[model samples]
Target: MQKTPKKDKEVINVIIQEYQKNDLPWYIGYSGGKDSSSMLKLVFNALKRIEYFHKPITVLYCDTGVENPIVTTYVYETFEKLKKECKQLNIPLLFTILKPKLEDRFFVKVIGRGYPTPTNIFRWCTDKLRINPVKELIDKDVKAVILLGVRSSESEQRDRTISKHKTDNEYYLKQSGSSSNIIFSPIINHALEDVWLTLRYNELPKSIDFNQIRMIYKDAESECPVYRESKGSSCGNSRFGCWTCTVVRKDKSMGNMIENGYSELKELFEFRNWIAEFRDNIKYRCSYRRNGAKGLGPITLEGRKIILDKLLKTEQLSGLNLIPQEEINRIYELWEIDEINVNYQEKRLTTTCIKHG
Candidate 1:
């Protein structure tokens, strides 16, 4: 057996102490990325060293449905193996995949309700797609500790945010807008190399292919937060998000993944590139806001239809299920509602103009 490093041992001991501190269920926010993977590994080792399981430790993964297909497949497969092996090993770890509500799904907003693709200024996808689902689940518990894999070294913005949220314990943080639950980052102090070391050294739960993660990282370098708490935090900067993300001027990571021979990403990449440009085309957007105010607003009904058509075409070309059938149904329902509202607004304007004339 490989020996654990002194730092890792220290962190694992702290994990055990924290685990045994109270009856509060522990929820680990896992993204299947290096930092989260390391945190999970440390927690797993801590559990192995202990004798009795008093409280539930659930691992929560948010699947935005639009996550990069490569990472998504890896996570799904890893979870299957983890479920089986953890049961055999009696680790008592529960794994759950959280998803956005139908109305909040990416396509439902963009293609159904005519939401323009998210730009940095108009970014709305993170809250609806990623954070809300996790928040809703955590809210069910009276009080819980959320374990995230966020690191201070990722960026200066992240460092400042972490420092601002500091709790009495350096490893813990107070979650914004929530008084009930607190955040715990096990690998908060770990540098980037330290994170990789954790994955490299701690090899238990062989279900997680650390090597495969390394290979993926070679092609795609960064990760979006699984649970976002602060506005200053990092996301969608060459990290993974919806393949259709347009917030970043360019999605260098996905581009790199394609160049690195992830051929499956080719069609999706092209479609994303097209849509990023497409969202900016004024011809596809309504001149008035959804609220009837004069401003650039949601995509026009015709724009939504065109986007849906192209999305379907892309789906066929990529051989991937880009959007779920339920989302499609919801999109159509939203379209109906929007069409009625648009007609009503037009009629009101016409009536006012005739009276003035």
Candidate 2:
């Protein structure tokens, strides 16, 4: 018998191979981004071929909770349409929405409790907002295999030494020696052109429309924030997230959307800008440092001195909803830690995970 050639494996075919596993649950890390969409298409096609196994494949959408309404609506609609159609066709596809804890949202932490915005030197949200929640979805009982959309072409950071990756010629898994969950990227071989060509050619069921997504991706100018590398030119669309991300200096995406007349996003945009300004004001933080006395650990990031009184002032001035007392109390508790010598960076995650509207 001749062995099947690895290069001959189509994206959909590679994904279909997973269906042979009656034991492990399949997890797709769908961020609703373009590459992820292409991966999603392959997954959809593959699952359709498995007529015998009625087991539902989990399509997990890690909602930042602050995603642009446009993307948010598209993601939900696509999932709903697929869920209904698959159920009707007896295809057994289940869509689940996963999100970072509410307190982990940027607005909740930064605007509510004055946690500083995320930066390259420190990105506290990845685990809580992107990676961790997805891991929880995999659960511990099974040999979980996750399907990630990441391709080597996306960024230099992603294009590390090939040996560092776990690819058997055609696909790469996120596990690439990092994450604990077993993950795979089937479209790792396909280029941007192939993905677009495939999407353009595939006559998707009427329920699974990508019209809105097409338009948004057309005008999108930034990369996805979750895995986006700092100091690189923006790729993909919408700054890797909602137009409201304050982590970047001046959210070009949100401003562009507003220029494009997504005026409905006005509230969200204003909220983001306010958060950026609050982060810029280092004086609102503790000059002495998070520790009772600051000597030196990591240098204090700018705007580490903002206190609660000013946070209230920012609430009044910026019209942002005030932070809940629970989160403020949490931040205060964190401040007591002598090890918190890193300034605003140290609190980014802790505060993001506690600040509630």
Candidate 3:
């Protein structure tokens, strides 16, 4: 390991002190990205240095079920290694993976219910796939502190939001119709270069491959897939998001990753592009919203069936189970119900017309 800088040491020391002082359980958001990786390293190091502190520290990972295959594998392997190491060190560390409910799954919403592909304005994926799952866990814990890897230097709007919600050692996150939770961003002030340097110099767990992470960074530019809009930038342009994301005009991250030698992902990339094309065509989308408004809504039933067939073909080509069997079953059930309802409505309309005539 390289020598740690004075500022880095000071920041680590502050983190240690805060962890020691807080009695509340700590939940670190691990998105399997660079910033989250750095934050976890700092916290883990701090805990290692402590003698007998006993407040539980849990790392929470929200698996959207649509993450890049490479990232998902890396994160799971790293977590398993961290669990083993923490056990050997007698460190009170726990890792939990949170997943969205079946009803809220990507395919269930898109293909099952004929929902349109997510767009910049109608980005319904984030809340259902990412935030709500994690938030559900956070809400269960009373007075818990959630640690995030967000950095102020990442964007101007982020800096302002961080500053606005700044507290003594954490930020306040207001949950909808629920009590607020505290969020601590230890690396909020750190620049991008500082983050990379820390990851390079710090003695991270053996499970973490800094070099692999560096490669991913080189390819993707940014980590988290969920889009966050900033001044002159957006997550779609720079960050790693679901391969099937249609919000961005282009999925540069996945394209770069393929260019960098992950050729197996080509099928997935092509499928994502096809989804975007399908969503853009007016013939595939419904002319009215779910509430009967004259606006864009879910895809038409025929469009949904076509999408499912194509998706299944993509899965076969990619050699990966893109959608879970349970989700597929649920989608089929929904389609049956939709068909039944349509038939019943048509019969009822015919009967009423005969009576009136």
lDDT per residue, candidate 1, 133-160, as tens digits?
A: 9989988999989999877787777788
Query: What does the lDDT read for residue 148 in candidate 3?
Result: 77
- For this target, which candidate reaches the highest TM-score against the unseen true structure? 1
Q: Once superposed on the true structure, which residue ranges of model 3 sit more than 4 Å away at CA?
A: 168-179, 225-238, 342-357
Off by more than 4 A, model 1: 219-221, 231-234, 342-357
Candidate 2 lDDT score at position 112:
40
Better of 2 and 3 by lDDT: 3
Regions more than 4 Å wrong, model 2: 1-9, 111-113, 161-163, 174-180, 221-238, 291-357
Candidate with maximal lDDT: 1
Give model 2's TM-score versus the native structure: 0.73
What digit string (tens of lDDT, one per residue) describes model 2 on residues 258-354? 7777766666667667656665553345444333453212213223334345555655664544455665665555444423433333454322111
The sequence of per-residue lDDT tens digits that candidate 3 reaches over residues 98-134 is 8999999999999998777888877788778877787
CA lDDT, every model vs. true structure: 0.82, 0.57, 0.75
